[model samples]
Target: MIFAIETAALQTFDGAFADELFLVARILFGGVIAFIGLNHFLNLEEMAGYAEYKGAPAPTLSVGASGVVLVLGGLAVALGAFPTLAAGALAGFLVVATPMMHDFWAVPEDQRQDELNSFLKNVGLLGMTVLLLAVSTVEWPYAVGVGLV
Candidate 1:
């Protein structure tokens, strides 16, 4: 009886630890994305200028729209509110933004490495967001939300 009780206790602790890890990962991903999205608003003009430089049409409007998407998508993913929609939006954003903004191969050799790094980073973020879309079948313990897979 004593051994059985001890094993149960150990299992409970392990399960709790795993739950905590999931919570932390969700918080971090959401927080970071929100922060980046906020930055877009905070520096709208500068971001627009940069986007314009990169040949984006209606730079100011486009950048603002993108910012809105980021904020909404980031929050949705983070809060586990609408994981599928959020992940899809974010993934789509990355797909377009990565190639359009981080076209390393199209840039001059001197800028190639930097652009490559940026491209890869965006790709990685896209991958994570897409992954969130893949296993979004969770019923969610409550109304609020939970972490990615």
Candidate 2:
């Protein structure tokens, strides 16, 4: 009984540590997204230019929509208010934005390497967000299930 208690205590501590790390990462990533989104909103012209460079239609509208998605997604991720949904949304957005906006494949060979790095980073972020969604949902199924009860 005593041994079992000790083991359980250790597990609890480990779980808490893991949760803290997750929270830190989530907040940092979410904050970055939020900042970028705000920049897009604040500098519509600049974002529109970027949109044009990406060959997107209605540059201003595209920029504004992306900005809104980023802001909302970031807020959701930061709060962990609906971790699964938020993370999934972020993952999808990253997937679309990375290839559409970044365009790693179109760069010069030398610059392609750097662009690829950015692309991969965004891909990794998407993966991480997806994993976060899965893990958070699985770990707290009850919370994500009915209501938070």
Best of the candidates, lDDT: 1
Off by over 4 Å in 2: 1-16, 109-114, 139-149
Could you say which candidate leads in TM-score? 1
lDDT of 1 by residue, 1-149 (tens): 45543432122214556656655666777677777788889999999998998999899998888888888888776677877778888889889988998899899999999999999999888888866676455543322655344
Report the CA-based lDDT of candidate 2 relative to the real structure: 0.74
lDDT of 2 by residue, 29-147 (tens): 88887887898889999879978977988999988998888888787777666666677777888988899876778977887888788889888888878776656544432122321
Query: lDDT of all predictions, in order shown?
Result: 0.77, 0.74
* Model 1: how far residue 20 lies from native, Å: 2.2
TM-score, every prediction: 0.81, 0.75
